[model samples]
Target: MDMSRLIETPLHRLAHGRTGDKGNRINISVIAYRAEFFPVIREQVTAERVAELFSHRRPTKVERYELPRLGALNFVIDDVLEGGVNDALNLDGHGKTNAFLVLSIPVWVPETILQLREEITA
Candidate 1:
């Protein structure tokens, strides 16, 4: 693969995410900034990668649900909250940090997409 045209960026640059919780499980949704960017995000970001990223939290399981029409991926992570909201030690017991942590995931995209991102931002 030609590396020059590929731009390595955190997932946040290509997508935005939100998170919620159900007991100890965290539900995170990642939506691509552009429809064209969805394929790259889908191909690069996998449940395995997410599981690896949250290894410190020791999630029992990670499942990814794809919403192609919405250009989104929803990840259900189990047992990362230290317990349910009432029992969690963190200030944001809903595992609010999960989405930002997931966004830290790195992805490689073509230069054209990078340009599109800049345009969207601008």
Candidate 2:
């Protein structure tokens, strides 16, 4: 696969939000329907790799963790937003910044996984 094209594709942009704080870091929890996708997602979001993927913006920090039981991957990104939850609450009501931050990573998965997620949630 052409990695550059994949990174620049609209799918990636849509999967991940465009507006990132670029100043305050936040923790994002990503749950995959299957364990197989963990490594692929990790490779796409690694600190060094993410910098290149999001070359236009810089992140202060990126930490990855494995949720084996849930078949998930959790990422803690530093400085991806401004002022963290405090600013979000103060400025945007309710005080939740993590939701937007979590939306900023393009989590690639199969259609089956998407269906499974809907099923579980429903």
TM-score of each: 0.93, 0.45
Local error of candidate 1 at residue 122 (angstroms): 2.7
Task: List candidate 2 stretches off by more than 4 Å.
Answer: 1-24, 49-58, 88-122
lDDT of 2 by residue, 46-78 (tens): 555444443443566677666667655556566
lDDT of each: 0.91, 0.47
Q: What is candidate 2's CA lDDT for residue 69?
A: 76
Error of 1 at 85 (Å): 0.8
TM-score of 2: 0.45
Query: For residue 11, what is the lDDT in candidate 1?
Result: 96
Q: Give candidate 1 misplaced runs (Cα > 4 Å).
A: 1-4
Give the Cα error of residue 34 in candidate 1, in Å: 0.3
Candidate 1 at residue 62, lDDT? 97
